[model samples]
Target chain A: MIPFRFSYHKPSSLSEAFEILSEDGAVPMLGGTDLVVKMRAKRVTPKVVVDLKFIDELHNVSFSEDEGLVIGAAVTMNELIEDFAVVKERFPVFYQAIKKVGAYQTRNRATVAGNIANSSPAADSVPPLLTYNAKVKVVSADGERLVELKDFFTGPGRNVLKPGEIIHSIIVPYESPSIGMYYKISRIKAVDLSTIGVALTIIDPDGKRDIRVALASVAPTPVRAFKAEDYIRDKELSASSVERFAELVQESTSPITDARGSKEYRWEMAKVLPKRILRELGLFEGVA
Target chain B: MTITLNVNGKNVQVDVQPNETLLDVLRNKLYITGPKEGCGNGECGACTILYNGKVVNSCLVLALEADGAEILTIEGLTKDGRLHPIQEAFIEENAFQCGFCTPGFVISTKALLDRNPNPSNEDIIEALAGNLCRCTGYQTILKAVKRAAEKLGVEK
Candidate 1:
């Protein structure tokens, strides 16, 4: 059980939530899968927990061809997967990423916004979101702003969310025809943290090939391999070019040795997984 | 804070501290010990419960968050004191050894069969991934789920 006593506030609106969160020890909570665990471990001791699930606007999942998809903060991974077929069709990488988080039970309560806010380097959703070029809508008492998802993280367990500011929704803009995959290496088949995660999306619009690559648990935070993407943008699909791309992707990561995996193993998989994913997608014309 | 929960088809009101978890309230306050506390950190599914018709680890949910929510524990699976088909199937198929993890597995199986009356092996494996059983090697448990599906299918 949580070791401390704290006031609980369920705000019906963002304004009320902001009003209560303006206080010193107020932290916004949704799903509480991560927050409550932290509270029990004494990692965070807030005086008040502003429940964001009560806000109606935060329960929305609207999609349009023009605006893409806007997922409210309260939307759980299971809810998204069950309710929308468009997410699976349009963002398969994101679908795989969400499906790989925790297990069936935890996904029923774990929210995408919470997943992003918790800001774990090994978070399954962040790499896919990075590949999608998602944006976070940050709402505060003063005003609101949209931050690029790539720029939102400062470090492990840290983000750009300031006091009294809460994430409103995640916006994934519409993309052209693309095929994406999220490949994760974990110790177990289910309910395990990713030892190494790689998300790759190849978008072809008007005969132009655009490759996007992002990885998790390989650095201080989930990051996109911009240099690798640039190198493979116009390169032919050959054994040597794919190997060169993998090398660049490996260079972009600075993994640490931990119980999950050694730094050397993470580096090796960082190179291997991307190539494996590319081959599986039939994007590589190289040997197995 | 005083919160009213619809537990096992009965609306009950109880006072709970904000720090108390749903698992704690269910086992300690309400005397509902069906959901066991194994790992307490959610790694083990021994404390699994159906929260608003969805299977979730009760240890991870705050009591306040479950306010006004519908909860179904293993105790709720019986009707007229007769065991649920899933539970009966477990006994018939010898699905458990110590029976410690049986409640959680039974609850998860109920959830899965509720959604899909006919489930394949992959479906059963996916649904029960959160629940771990060191005994029986899961082969008997898998048979129990299939048998439960057949029983429920006939009843339906």
Candidate 2:
């Protein structure tokens, strides 16, 4: 049980929620998947917990050809899974990555906004968002702004979010004729955190090939492997070229030795996983 | 905070602290102890319950969150003094030794069946992955789920 006493505020609108969040020691809560746990552990002792579920604007999920996909902060993992058709058709790699967020029950309560807001280095969803060049719509009583997902993180469990600023929604731009993949090494097959997560997206619209690669749990925050991506972009992903690309990707990581895995192991897997995924996708052919 | 909850088909009002969890309110104030607290955190699903017909760990849910919510605990599984089919199947299959995790398993099975009446073996495994049992080897639980599914009169 939580030992601290905290006031609860269930705001019915975005403005009201913003007002509540602007107060000192007030934290915005979406699904309570992360905040509640932190509260119970005394890691986050807020004087007031602002519940955002009552705000209708925060529960919306909309997609269009021009506007792309807009997923509100309150969209739960289960809601996304139920809308799998659109997600699979639009962002297949994101659909695959979100499916690995948590177990079924936890997903029922975990929200996409919370996962991104938590800013864990091993977050399963961040890498895919990076691959998609997603943007976070941050709002406050003052105003609103959109931050690129790549520049959102500042450190482990921290972001550039100012006090009273809440993530309103995530905006993923639509890409046609694209293919992507996400791979992660975890302790258990399911219901476990990622030791090293990798996501790759290749967009070939109008015959202009573009590749984006991102990794998680290998740095202070989730990062894109820009060097490897640039090295392999528009080039035939032959075995040797892909090997060199993987080495560059490995060089980009700065993983630390922890109880989950050794720094050497994470760095090695950072190289091996992308290559394995590339080979599986038939982008690279090699001898067995 | 004082909140009214629709629990087990009954509207009950209880006073709870803002920091209290749904599990705490269910066991302490409501006097419904079917939901066990094996892990206060959500890692273990022993505190699983149906919130708005979807399975969620009660320990992770705040008491304030359930103010106007409809909750179904293990105590609500029976009807007309007869055990639910899943409960009966558990008995016939001897699905539990400690029984601490049985409530969560039963609740999750109900949810799975409600969504997919004829779930494959892999489907059952995936649906029940969050609930952990130290005894009965889980094979018996699988058999019990199969039996329950059959008794629910859905084609395999």
Candidate 3:
């Protein structure tokens, strides 16, 4: 189906793109792997579309020793998978989730930024990004600001980003001793959005342990289960303890029954997976 | 608007509408029909094409999104009607039965080979996951991809 009538502007530079976005309800598009289809379905229609494909800066992927990993808004999932650091730096969990999003064809077209900006409760990337305690760098006609990934989304398909503001990049904070695990539950193995997604990361720095559990499709937004973390802290990271914590996480969440999965099933998986992950990282002891 | 795009190693100019998908412009306005339209949305890989050296579903990308970009379709794989090694491997192996999905498979396989000259059977499976074919049952198609990679001079 053809999208609703709209004017398209291909901006050569980000400044030009910003100027366009500043217009009332003007939208900036990158990759368009999701937005175009959404538009065709009448989910969203705008007076104009500011195409950011020509803006080279928006598609950049950079690595640094001091600052950390910075991915541009237009960086595709296929490019992210090719990164040696992302795949090999003890983050195999992410590779698993990224591998499950759509198919090889969709990954080649889907942008990490687009997934985040869409802010769907079921987006596979959000839980992981939230688990990493990632940061979103947004730009607008007013100025630029960095919002913690957890704070970026206010509710399902809703975000704090105001009109004329665009997400510029996402930052995964640099940490030397970090272990991350990600998992997603879907009805079919291919191309379906997550029914519930979870990203678990534990970092032991200077003998201070920071465990982050971020999940999606469990609440109005992908959120961190702080109450669950509080229950397990200072306990010798063990299987039984992890199990106890997982149960607490299930209790804390208000999962709903949607087309993807029932509220009860989401709660059960939410409890089961995190404990299993904690065990894999030697944070649990009950497993043989 | 008039946009300059490089297609099949030749620089071409075309008039584009703002809302039209790249697949529409490539198949209709520019007349490069190698990329077929299976699902106008990105669910199917039939309209897959290379945009700036990265494989993308053309149907999901707007025509203006591809301006000043380098594009390669099934038509661009061979030079002067010479069959690309992958192309030959597809025909020789009879990798496809219905042939509608063959072009997308061949193009996506080309992308895999270009990036990783030595991909495992698992890699081949993942790369072709988005392209569906009811005819081949995937065994022959998988072998054909491995054959192309071998022809590209990669071990395993």
Candidate 4:
């Protein structure tokens, strides 16, 4: 049980949630898989806990060719996997990453928005979302705005969200003929944070091998390997060039030694995993 | 806060604090001890229960959020006084050692069987990944799940 006293409010509408969140010490809770644990540990003590799952607008998951994919803030990982086949067919990397978030019971309550909102560097969903170039739809009592997923995180456990502002949904632009995967090294097979995560997507539309690489657990936040992407743009992914690309990807990281892994080990894997993963994804050509 | 919950097919009203977890209410207030508290956080699945027909950790769920929702714990698995088929299979297979994590494993297995009915070994592994057995008696537990599946009329 939590060691503090807090009032709970379940708002039926966004306006109500905004009104409650505008007050001092009022916090919006999506799934509470992370927040409730923090509260129990006394890391976060709020006077009012506003539950946002009751809002009808936050339960939407709609996709279209024009609008791409729009997943609401309250959509759980299980709902995304079971109810929507499009996610697996179109965004396999995102689907696989979501499956690796915690375990089955936690996934039943965990939301993608909550995962992003937590702003953890080891969050499984961020690397895949970053590779997909997802956008965060932020809503406030005054209005709403869209922020790029790459620029969303400010630091560890920090984001651009202001008071009274909540994420409405995540928007993923539709890309065709693209296949990608998220490979993570965790302490165990499941239920542990990723020691290092790499998401690689090769968009080969009209033979343009536009490879996008994003990584987690190597920095303060999940980041895209822009230098590597620039180096490998439209070039044939040969063994030597892929090795160089892997080195550039490793150059982009500024990791620290923690309990999960050493900084040197992360730097090494940051270089090694990309090539192996590239080969595993069948993007590498002519021997590793 | 006063909330009404349909627990084990019975509608009951209880007063709970907003900060209190559903696991605390089930084990402390209502005295339903089926869901154990191995870890206060969700790392261990000792408090697994069916919330609105989906398996979730009760410790992570607020008691207030569970208001008016249907809940099923391990106690609900028994009919009259007879043990559930899953429970019988567990005993027959000696699926547990110390038995602290039995309730959660049973609930997770039931959730899996209810949905899949004939689950593959991969399916069972995925479903029970949240639950951890300190006794390390997973082989027999797996056998029990398969045995329960057999008893439910699905061949292996």
Candidate 5:
């Protein structure tokens, strides 16, 4: 667990952090849960670690009618799980994915921005956030811009974030007129990547309407199961639809086998999970 | 660099090197030997501590980043020479074999029970997942958690 020597800078304000990020070879650290591990692995040895703990704007979770939910970049996974609004309304799948992130201890320190910024292909939060159509706000020396969450990740452990640009917050639209949930099947319940993760949000309009299903760990990035979703729209939910959608979801993802689980296992579970989630959400009656 | 951490209810300010972790600052400088270093990459929970009342991997956290934050170690579990309910439960349940992991477990359990007094079996397992015990005394550890819950009388 050896990392190269580096300069430490604790910036209390957003402008100070922007100045640091504008410098060459600088990395903005929120919680250091991901950054330190990568540093020890010698994967990313930046010359300076700009700690953003003092930045008040990057450390809050607030609600707004105009913008939806504004989640600070430094908000930990534990905070998301314990947030009353998140647990009750906006999204329950986010909590389900968060619970499997690690142990309770690590979650307390692992920030949501770090989880997304680390850009792991199997990050539990991304898929569900993608399902919700979340937006990321990136701040730099020049200014800030919002990017769609689905377009945030470019590849495994990578994103399109420009040099000297730091993610300040994520904006999730509170369009939760549906029952949304996430399910992941891992080797074990804790500290492991998902073999396949499924997120479903069914918006029932007077028992006759539209639904959306998004899934992850099935492709290079979290993908929306548009084909399967189109199959269930405006149709009465039932066991037959669940089976059909399950079959359709298997065709949606491109899962690979690593140490976590087999590609076949993931493909198989990818089919099973969506239908199970729909059932649990009461969209598909008598299918649990 | 000088860093001030409110450790164990005491405001102790100390200076450390650029490449020092919270674990290094605690054990080496402040002489707060409660947080032991196991796997310094945040996998093992040997260096667990309560930062702002939430359990975190102290080894991964830089000392400079923890300035002005309230930290609680196993030593802080007792007040006026009275053991915390979780600590008493451990003693009553005989929850240790070699005891190297006791302090970390005690602090971790305190964080869990404080937030959720009547955590379910799954909750307990989830809370302790980061901690590892070579003695395999998880049964007694679970018993201690149950005992603490009973002593508190807050079931969920």
Candidate 6:
């Protein structure tokens, strides 16, 4: 049984939810997949648990060519997988990362917003969201603001969100003409957290090739490989170039040794995954 | 606070604490013990149940969150003294040795079949990934799902 008790509030509107969030010791819950686990473990004991599922605006998953995709805080992973064709065709890296977030049962209730809001270093969704240049829309009684996914996290299990703020939606800008892929190294094939997750997006916007690479579980927060991305951008794909790119990618991580894997192993994988992904993308013709 | 939950096709109102889990309320107050609490956390899907037609770990769902929703547990799989086809298939296939994890597997399989009446082997494996079994080796359980799919007249 849960050891502690908290008052539950289900608000029907965004303003009402924001007002409830302003209460002292109040926590906003979207799917409760992560929060419930934490509550059971006594990691957090909020006096009030604000359930956000009742807010109509928080359940939407709308997309348009001009405005791109806006995933509401309550939109489940399964809902994103099933409803958004753009996720499948345009942002397949995000789709693949969502598939690895959890098993089907948990994914049925786990939300994209919660995945980011949790801010776990090993969270599978973060790297891909980073590659997509996603923006998090957070609301409070004060006002609303959009934080870029890159600048969202401050540390493991922490973000820039103020105590009174709750994420309203996540905005993914219009799909650029690009090829993207997500690669994750996990302990098991199913229902496991990522030991190392990588998302790479190669775009040729305005005839200038741009490469973006993001890695998870290799640092305090999911981070982009800026140096490595710059090194490979506009460069011809070659075995040596990709090898050097992987080396730069490895240099960017600051992983720690934990039960899941060793620091050294993660460092090596931080390099290996990018090379493997590049090979799979046919950017490199020969095995390195 | 009191919450009304639609369980097994019937609405039952029960007084539950704000932090009480749906599994706790179901087993303690409502006496719907079909869902077992193998792990209070969601890792073990022994408490799997259908919430609004989607399979979820009831242990992770707050009882208040379940209010105004429909839930189907292992006990609800039977109707008019007739076992669900999935349960019948499990029995015919000898899918359980200790039978402790049967309820969760049955519920998960029911959810999978409802969505994809004819699931492939990979699909079946993916759907049952969250549910674990210590007694049976899962081969018979796979066969049971296949048999149930055939019994439901949508075999692939």
TM-score pick, better of 4 and 5? 4
Fnat measured on candidate 1? 0.75
Better of 3 and 6 by DockQ: 6
Full-model lDDT for every candidate: 0.91, 0.88, 0.80, 0.91, 0.80, 0.88
TM-score of decoy 4? 0.98
Chain B TM, per prediction: 0.98, 0.97, 0.95, 0.97, 0.94, 0.97
lDDT of 5 by residue, A11-72 (tens): 98988888887777789888787888788788898888898867887888887646777789
- Chain A TM-score for candidate 2 is 0.96
Candidate 2 structure quality by residue, lDDT tens digits, A106-218: 89999889999999999898898898889999998889999999999999999999998999999999876567789988997677789999998777634776877899899
Better of 2 and 3 by TM-score: 2
Q: Pick the candidate with the highest DockQ.
A: 4
Per-model interface RMSD values are 1.0, 1.0, 1.7, 0.6, 1.7, 1.0
How far out, in Å, is residue A195 in model 1? 0.5
Comparing 4 and 6 by DockQ, which wins? 4
Q: Candidate 3 chain A: minimum summed lDDT over ten consecutive residues — where? A: A84-93
- What global local distance difference test value does model 5 have? 0.80
What TM-score would each prediction reach against the true structure?
Answer: 0.98, 0.96, 0.91, 0.98, 0.91, 0.96
Model 4 Cα displacement at B146 (Å)? Answer: 1.4
Q: Backbone collision count in every prediction?
A: 0, 0, 5, 0, 0, 0
For residue A166, give model 3's deviation from the true position in Å: 1.2
For model 2, the stretches where C-alpha displacement exceeds 4 angstroms are: A205-209, B154-156
lDDT of each residue in B1-156, candidate 2, tens digit only: 789999999998899888899999999888999999987778778999999989999998889978989999989989989999999999999999989999999999999999988899999988888898999879999999999999987533
Residue-level lDDT tens digits of model 3 in A52-117: 766888877776756667888877787787754554463444556677788877887777788888
